[model samples]
Target: MKAMRFTPPGYGGRRRDPDEVKRDGWRKQGLLAVSLDDQRLTWPERELVRQLGERLYGARLDKTEDKR
Candidate 1:
């Protein structure tokens, strides 16, 4: 499986590769393990993520404050 990348919404930064993030969820808590290739999100879920990203990480808002 290729490296996993996670760029959580509302976080001001570039996408974070899986290697960069810790897998504490499995080490600390016995939560279900998610494989890089096994992780799949539904279309709706994906759309929601896109929308949230646009709202949060969208281009600087104040830059276009004037409606001229």
Candidate 2:
């Protein structure tokens, strides 16, 4: 019997030579890359995306604001 060790997300036992995160996802899971507007994301995931977007870009547009 072997005990499983839990590692943090980025520091886990992943390949070092080449990053397998996106490649494996594209190959195995048939899932594309990250999308902030993906409907499959949960509320927390959406919030994280929103925060990251605002952090990188400017603040999000208000819903009440009209786009010309």
Candidate 3:
């Protein structure tokens, strides 16, 4: 039997390279943007999208429509 070790998000076993992180982040952002643009989600889905975008971008998602 082998023991497994756990690590945090940004620092884990077999650490990811800087370039890999940047590339993957960019890809995820692209997909998220496309999904938002499609405007096919219900309220909860939209909230999830916004939360994830805020997390990945380190800023709040625009709330222009929320004011309505």
Against the unseen true structure, what C-alpha lDDT does each candidate score? 0.57, 0.73, 0.64
Per-residue alpha-carbon lDDT of candidate 1 for residues 1-68, written as tens digits (9 for 90 to 100): 97648856857678666643546555676544333233376767666665665786674336559743
Q: Estimate each model's TM-score.
A: 0.34, 0.39, 0.34
Poorly placed runs, candidate 3 (over 4 Å) = 1-32, 35-38, 60-68
- Estimate, for each residue in 1-68, the C-alpha lDDT of model 2 and write its tens digit: 87657776767565554335666878998965556766889989988877877897779678899865
In candidate 3, what are the lDDT values of residues 1-68, reduced to their tens digit? 87657655767568787657766877877532335444667878877887787787666436764532
Winner on lDDT between 2 and 3 is 2
- lDDT (Cα, 0-100) at 13 in candidate 1: 73
TM-score for candidate 1? 0.34
Q: Would you give me the overall lDDT of model 1? A: 0.57
How many clashing residue pairs, candidate 2? 0
Q: Please give the lDDT score at residue 16 for candidate 2.
A: 53
Which ten residues in a row are the worst by lDDT in model 2? 12-21
